[model samples]
Target: MRTTDTLNVIAANSRVLVGPLVLLVVLLLLFVFALRVGIGQIISLSKKVAESKVEEQVLSQKLEILKTSEESALPLADLSLVAIPSENPALIVISQLKNLAGEKGVGLSNIEAKQTAAVASIFHTEIEVTVEGEMGSLFDFLKGLGSISPLLTLDQVIIRQESGIAKVDALIFGNFAPLPTTLPSITSPLDELTAEEKDILAKISSYSQPVFTEVTPSGPFERVDLFNF
Candidate 1:
């Protein structure tokens, strides 16, 4: 009877410990799964950080390149605008023509201007004028007109060279475009000016820009009071 009771007590103790052991196993499995998930998240974050670093480096390089380009490209860009004006260049071209005529010993007369729209959103001014001088001077004046900035195209020229004196009638055209109102996308890559473009800019830069002097037109000089309207 004593041996049977001892055996029954041992069985009861084993049954009581079974639930705790099972609970410990479940807790251990949950902890292991949690650790694995935490490790995976850390690795993912590390990769993201590395990628971000590479992007930052590339952006920094592009910024440096733009800074260097701004210094070198600004003058050429301004020259390009002067070469192809953003407004009607008729007056400017007229001034240049007069200067060229004076330099070439030619007389300017019958100046007329008429503006008309051309293809490519371009506006051209048709200038009809007469230049009279020696045959050589007239030819030189016409050549100078073509060489002036903002492009003066000679549509027609009627020349009468007799007795070393020539009278020429020219129909010249000058054009300009409207300025752009929209900016390009910032994400687009900047194209560096090629050698050919740089050479073209250099040639255009050599063209003489007209200088305007504020001269008082002949008028009655009268001292008016500043308070007078």
Candidate 2:
């Protein structure tokens, strides 16, 4: 009878221990799950913070560019001839051509201009020039014309050697900006140029200005019937 009673007490102790053991296992599982969730949240937050930092940096760079542009605004007087409005684009082109030819020792035999159709806000004119000079001087004259203000586009160039002289026939296109009714505001993005752009502007500015002569007032893009053979 005493052995039977000892067995019953041992059974009762195991029953009480089983409840606490199960509770401990449940608590361990809860702790592990909480740890995993906390780690995942931390990783997600870190990525978000990194993205925000990148976005902030990009915004700052754009703001800096805009600030620089505003600080370095250009005046109308300092603008290139192409950027300014022209009353007589053909006259400008003739003057520029005359100066370039004189500088390069090239003789201009004939020059004729015809107004082409306008495109957008700009008007276009076509010029044909016949010139005679040494081969080297002809090339130099072409190069100089390219660097001059109020940029000219060489449409076609034909060079031939005759009697030890280089004869050149060139077709060029000139762009004319329309007159502005009112002055543009200072907030224009084109008001400021980058360093590379400024370098180009400087090179063009170093060229000698073309001298204008008094000529009859002719409208922009007037049709001319002069033929150069």
Candidate 3:
């Protein structure tokens, strides 16, 4: 009887232990599944971080390129401005006049410059000017101004005699075109006349001499044989 009782108690303990062992096995499997899911999420986050870094690098490179382009373009724009004649049409006209007239002993007084449509459709602008000078000097000056590379015109001429001196007034026009055939790049006028521009001015110095030289007396007229009025 005692041996049977001991066997029954051992059987009951084994049944209880079987249920606990099955529950432990199920819990361990759930924990392993959760660990695997967490690892997958970590891998996905790492991939996103890598892709973001690549995007960041691409944006940085683009920004650097933009900066470099802006830096280099400034000088190129300046160069283009110099190469275009239309940028400052008035400047070319004034400069050419000053240079040419100065060389020819013709003083510029009451100069009037205006912009008009260019003679050729290809040019951006044409300058028209009204200038005053001595008649002999102006004739020579006109001939020289015409000798400019692109060509200049003596549009109109008016003459008046003032105390035996001939006063000349003329309107000159010209279209300054830049070489190397490019779209008009500059939008402003010429900054100042260049040395090359001054060379062409020598032409203004030439004048047609009158038949007789005029002599003027300062204070009073005297019966002088050597000098006469």
Candidate No. with top lDDT:
1
Each candidate's TM vs. the true structure?
0.65, 0.52, 0.36
Per-residue CA lDDT of candidate 2, range 1-229, in tens? 8999999999999999999999999999999999999999999999999977877776666567667655343332354665333654777778889888888998997799876656788776889999898888999998887777577779899999888778999998777776678975333333346687766666666656555458898766645665632
Clashing pairs in 3: 87-188, 87-189, 88-188, 88-189, 104-205
Task: Give the C-alpha lDDT of model 2.
Answer: 0.75
Query: What's model 3's overall lDDT?
Result: 0.59
Error of 3 at 228 (Å): 68
Greater TM-score among 2 and 3 belongs to 2
Clash tally, candidates in order: 0, 1, 5
Candidate 3 residue-wise lDDT, 1-229, digit = tens: 8999999999999998999899999999999999999999999999999977877776666566557655544334433333334443555556667777777887677666665555454344344444455777868876776543234566677777767666666666555555555553232222333455433333322221112237875866457786654
Model 2 C-alpha RMSD to native:
13.7
Cα error, residue 167 of model 2, in Å, equals 0.4
- After superposition, which runs of candidate 3 have C-alpha atoms over 4 Å from their true positions? 1-84, 120-134, 177-229
Off by over 4 Å in 1: 1-65, 161-164, 212-229
